[model samples]
Target: MDKRYVRAAVIALMLAGLTLHGGIASAQQKRDTIRIGFVTFLSGPAAGPFGVPARMAAEAVVEQLNAGKAPAPYDTKGFGGTPIELVVIDEAGGTTKQVSEFRNLVSRQNVDYVIGYISSGDCLAIAPVAEEMKKVTVLFDCGTPRVFEEASYKYVFRTRPHATMDAVAAALYLLEQKSGVKSYGGINQNYAWGQDSWHDFDLAMKTLKPDARVTTSQMPKFGSGQYGAEISALIQSGSEVIHSSLWGGDLEAFMMQSVPRGLFRKSQLVLVAGEPYLHRLGANMPDGTIVGARGTHGVFAPDSNLNTWLKTIYKAKAGHDPNYPAYVATLAFLGLKTAFEKAKLEQASSLKPSDDALIATFEGLSFDSPSGRATMSLGKGHQAVMGTAYGTTKLVNGKVTVTNVKHYPAERVTPPNGISSPDWIKGGMKPGK
Candidate 1:
């Protein structure tokens, strides 16, 4: 046989092997499971209230999706028939540790995507790394504006609105609910989320209600669990209203300590991250306390098919209603699912979509959630903007629940594209386009 003919035959055999089992084996070999790095706090102070709920939400959402029982628009089974495999990581240690875990997930575990990070610090540090590694990372509920406000990324996306909405809506809620709110003060954890929340709330107050004076401001070290000095200072300040963005154990500890000190009765308490604790804290929270669920989540979550489904399953397993953290985590997973199906369907193929395809399709994608409509309206269409809801807690029939719930539309609270939160707030916080 001629040398050329033998070489050509060998090439044909190799090509034929690539098409074995009608490309089924080849496809499976390429990618059988979609690995996702699901990062959230699983240990330490934040575990019980914040991280555990989020973890439960992830498990339920994944199980339902794999079972092909998720509500419409998200009814597709596990990223277009490819089962999802999650590598759950605890976001406990700090930003540095979280960053290291993220690289481990991407490089060692070989995750295709990442969806996690409840801390703003983690999100801020991970966003650039996500871009650098060219991986698709979805931020569930960090809320700080600094992530996208300072820089832009093609791979990093947030499925929920940032802290600006939470803080702005919080201030706007107070302005609408109260009269003669002439003075205010805050006791927030001294971290990115805390600092950002307090700053935005202060700025929004300054812009909305110019007369609202800052009687005092306190920044306690995170996880300190002791606010003796801060609470005493806030009580002495005699402010009409006291604001706090504390969440998880920190928020719980503050309420436990202050409620006994009669702080809530002395001054109106506005807990921006308080909706989850409404039931847990019960009458201890005091009636008329202002609360927000970050967005349209938890007690303020609207009635919908998606909401009912998630709530029923989550409550069954978690033994309590899914809170704001769970709701936000579900939103992130659903967003990823929506994006994956969109990218996959455009090809009309059974194979999973490419990272570039998913990224292209996800930008500016508007999708439904358990809460409501979420649009990729900010950060050059890379970040999400969702409506935020706030309400005052009322104890009725022995259960702590929100009354007088009011939702601020995404357009009203979220800054429009091409503008940062500070600029928008300074420019009068004009409604989004």
Candidate 2:
């Protein structure tokens, strides 16, 4: 045999073996990996307070899941032995831009699961897109009740309670703590989340306390970063009680600007989603400011071994306590893990579970979170119902902390079956009574 011909034959064999090996590796990767697109406000005003911690929680949870070191029900080691690979996307632009980005994530990125959305407008925009594209998605933090109210979906579901719960919890807390507060005022971001929060809070007040009137309503643009005029309007309204659902940097700015203007001292303020700003505001946070996590979260509430573990891990990773955004994100990941495992168990095939399998598993599911139990409504458009916790803020040892905390079950605030929130209120069922 010629030396050149022999050498060429040897090289061809080597190349063939390498190609076979590569094909096997690719197949193994596909079977063992779960790709997730995790979207949150990585930039813009909501980044520092809300998105960053949530992202950190995502990183920590994924690391733990990959290592098979998480707590139970979540101890299954990464979605039933498959590793999680998360691609983080910044939710900065407007609703239209978000819709486009969502499409890109589903079609181009080819992610298995899509999670995270703090903006209500973004949530409303992306739900339909997820359904149209047949993408399985979990809206982790968006609280607008309008998502399910406006449309129905098979592949889209929110893993956290809706915005109406926060408002109802706040109103119930106010009436319980401050029965003398006959007049109230509201200042919320002028968007879907804010508008829905204000409306729900107002309706809750009317149903729970009929004598109480909303004297003034201020709808500041999202991320406006200024609330001096809105503060003045609130003050002039002579409201004995004030309500706000602002979160992230907007909430911080409002509190800072309002404190100097004596807004906090003048009226009792209730913040529907305020836990994110607690550490940032610290002593600057007004004493007696009634606030709630969108659900049971933050350092003061969610007193459990799971929450303790979460706080310890989150503080070690991000050098701070875990807040509502972080808690909700963690819960969302756990829910995903549960769904994937359940889907795997229910299916007959040994092959990897499909997106439809995951969706079916997620619908009408119940799982344990760090805070507590969370359930997805079986026939109610896949809406989630989680308990919420409220408390009063105080400067304790120069740190902002909540005390006198209370928990409201999901059924307390959630609208009845087949009834809108406004109609439920108009129907004269006083929540939390």
Which candidate tops TM-score?
1
Query: Which runs in model 1 stand beyond 4 Å of their true positions?
Result: 1-29
lDDT of 2 by residue, 1-433 (tens): 6899999999999999988775654455444578899999988877887888899999998998889888776877777877888989999998988888888676666677899798887988888888889988899988777788767888888888777778888888888898888899999999877888888888888878888887999999988998888999998998998888887778878888988888877799988877778878887788999988888877544567677778878989998788888988998998888888888987746544787887887888998878788888723638788778789988989988788888887788777556677787667654432
Q: Name the lDDT value of residue 160 in candidate 1.
A: 91
lDDT of 2: 0.82
TM-score on alpha carbons, each prediction: 0.91, 0.88
Whose lDDT is greatest here?
A: 1
Q: How far in Å is the alpha carbon of 111 misplaced in model 1?
A: 1.3
**Distance from true position, residue 141, model 1, in Å?**
1.5
Model 1 lDDT on a 0 to 1 scale: 0.87
